[model samples]
Target: MSSPTSVLLAGGGSAGHVSPLLALADTLTRRHPDLVVTALGTEEGLEARLIPARGFGLRFVPKVPLPRRPSADLLKLPGRLKAAVDAAGAAIDETGAEVVVGFGGYVSTPAYLAARRRRVPIVIHEQNARPGLANRVGARFTTFVATTFSTTDLPHARRIGMPLRREIATLDRSALRDEALAHFGLATEWPTVLVTGGSLGAKRLNDAFASTVAALSRGGVQVLHVTGQGKTFVPDVPAVGAPYVVVEYADRMELAYAAADLVVARSGANTVCELTTVGLPAVYVPLPIGNGEQRLNAADVVAAGGGLLVDDDALTPHWVETELIPLATDGDRLAVMARASAALGEPAADEQLADLVELAWGTRA
Candidate 1:
């Protein structure tokens, strides 16, 4: 029998990068059970825990963060990065990997350089509408690039969508709606709005949504709010007899997506992809900081009539009461937005990305 094709996947730091890498890894292994898949990440990155837990072999490399400004750290960057590249090259040699797929993070930069030095074919996947610094550097070494958004500016970028977990990619909201409502203890017939600020929570999202809970409840909209772990903000308004469910975290996001008619959240690339994939209309409040990638992530969905993008400063209690309440109550508008969102979703991204990796591998051989 022919030996299994060996592949090394590199990405880490945040769940945004790690999740898609896992999704792709899962896809490749499922399709070809004999495939040898390995992951490279930094000790500090979330991948250290997540990758192994998913039953894949993982190797660690040093995290060499790019210094944005001229400073003391910048002076030592060359040596630091060189050490990382050497470590990554060693992993490549040991695995005998034919192709290296990168999902942009601290690990990816070194992985790309090391793979280039070893003459291994490289494939890159960018999760955001705007490419990160690591992907930008890595793009120069490889012609094979895939992106979640069509507008992402990267070398030879092809729109392959975000690789989502099996649970999310195949979720049927209608079939699970009743079970989802029960899971959250929400009213079965009431229109619901789900609010989330990711796992660590967004203070701005928390404060705005908390202040407007009463108003939303008064509009006959039930709420399932997932406040990030240990984060809380109470509304000043006196409690009305409205359904307002609050939780520290949601372990089953599929149920959360199923139970909601409207969603209010940050527009991280992963969140945007999942929401659109599930056909959920959302009011995206981009984080006011960062390189404006959050805003860019939500732009296409908003432009495509799938959702609304509200600036962080503009998402006040008053705005929620006037704008959000009206939109949530309008069934006709919500249906239209849901359809638009589904139209933009690529549920087959995992398969598509695996195909891209194979194409790159073939080119190398």
Candidate 2:
């Protein structure tokens, strides 16, 4: 057997899945210029735009959400899954896909099934500390399974770490410090905290940071707050000494990462990986909902003394004044955390994952 000439990469609905999918796609294509890579996702997913924008062909599959409880959607699941699998199989057939790589989301289940039916090799990548249902199902048919977090419970799990964007994985914070400061219009004198609430912005984070902008400035700390798209945050008072830069969104996150000494944001799998990979300290405020995966995602780093992990509700304006202010201003502490974060990060994860894909294809009969 030889490496796959063509492969179908499936996953979507969120950045956690799409980011890795895109990163792996880029690596595989770069390694094999003649390789044919097509993405499978629903139009509703972020992948619909991201995949195509990245210059990969995308095939649509019906988004199938597995019900948590007995519902009318449960009754319709079989038909939806069948249709999605059929669509996925057709994509495989059309592209002459010899293997399938799935990142575990709404589109992964069908990609796994279709590849199994076609006798094509399947490689699964589980992103979170807790595996999602799609990856759990996909794992059954594949011996090649990769995970971002070591604590992730999945069959045949191999922790290759997260496949991160090239910009994030290769970011040299010190080297880009000046560029970052100039881009965000921050002073070089003050220690900066980067505050983000993911793409959509968490109201809790927005409000907390909004209320404490003056407090942070008074502590001689600069702040770069990305308030998410369409999410606005108006500061109550002007800065006392340091700059308070607020933007709706950051197109160049690498610059933002470069500018900040500490990050105050959600502990998303991608965020954890990127921050660690780039060797930046953070204050992780995990989203309060879902299966508690966000909190789990930051466990290893927090345990390693890389960052502070706090509950969503626990992350308040008061905490910013009491805890975050001191931490950001303490240069010695932030340096120690940055070293710990870098130690835990796997910068070569994209290459390692690409190896697994090749290994899986090579073993195919």
Candidate 3:
């Protein structure tokens, strides 16, 4: 009998990278129950806990991210890359993988390259508006390239939006607002703002929101703040008209979307896609750091008229008081932005990516 088909998937670093991989894994398993999927990542990454929690086996590889400028770690990159390649090869061998799918991170670079060396077909998913270094390198070896944006410059890249979870794809806030509000112990009478700082949270976002939450509350804005794991922020003690529900982290994102009138968060690719897919008008503050890729992602949404992007340096409570308060008040304007966001939604992207992955693996099989 032919051995059961297996796939080696690689992704790491942030939950943004890991969540999509898990989403795809969930989709693949639901479609083909017998197909084996193993995640290749670093032991230290967020994936180490997340991947296994989803019931998939994880194979670890040591990897250090390559910085743009030359440094001591740069000198060790060659050795680290070699080690990661060997680890990826072993994982592929152990899983009897017919092909590899890389989800664009440091972990993916060596794993996909190892698959290429072994003549195994590879597929890559570029989730960002601008491709990351790993996906850019992996694209050359990829049998097919899948991207969230149609404008990706990767050779032979196809327009398949980010693979979102079923809940996100089919979410409708109309009927569930009451239930979502009740879950957060909030009243449904007031305007709501959902503030999330990604899975790990953003300090800048937390600080800004903490400072402004009271003012928003006084303006009759109810808040659901996902503050990440370790951070704590105390809102004003006086019951200022509206409720402020704060959570360290939330697993039920769909519910959060349903309960929100507007979103105030960082513009990570996952957040961008979720906001677009759910048709949520948002004030996006991209993490102001290296490469400015997050800003680029936010620019696409702002340029598309779906949301507004704020520079981190300029994100003050006064600005929020002026801009976001007014924007939130104008329901008509919010609806216009919502329509623009809905226009960008791609609900069928998961199936499209599945088809691409199957085709890539089928040829090798």
Over 1-365, each residue of candidate 1 has an lDDT whose tens digit, in order, gives 34347899999989999999999999999988988899999888899899999999999999998888999999999999999999999999999899999999899999999999989999999999999988999999989999999999998999989999999999999999999999988887678999999999988888888887778787877888899999955444336645888888999999999999999999999999999999999999999998999999999999999999999999888998988888988999999999999998989999999988888887774
TM-score of 2: 0.97
Q: TM-score for each prediction?
A: 0.96, 0.97, 0.94
Best by lDDT: 2
Worst lDDT 10-window in candidate 1:
233-242
- Per-model lDDT: 0.91, 0.92, 0.84
Task: Sort all candidates by lDDT, best to worst.
Answer: 2, 1, 3
- Between candidates 1 and 2, name the one with more favorable lDDT: 2
Tens-digit lDDT string for candidate 3 (1-365): 33337988899887778878888888888888998999999888999998998899999998758878988888888998899899999999899998788988889999878998898889899888789888899888765999887666787899888888899988998778888999888897888889888767888778877888778787777788899898867777345478888898887889999998899998888888889988998999888887777877777678889899888877788887777777777889888998898888888788887788888876773
For model 2, name the residue pairs that clash.
none
Model 3 spans > 4 angstroms off: 1-4, 237-240
**Which residue runs does candidate 2 get wrong by more than 4 Å?**
1-3, 236-239
Which candidate has the top score in TM-score? 2
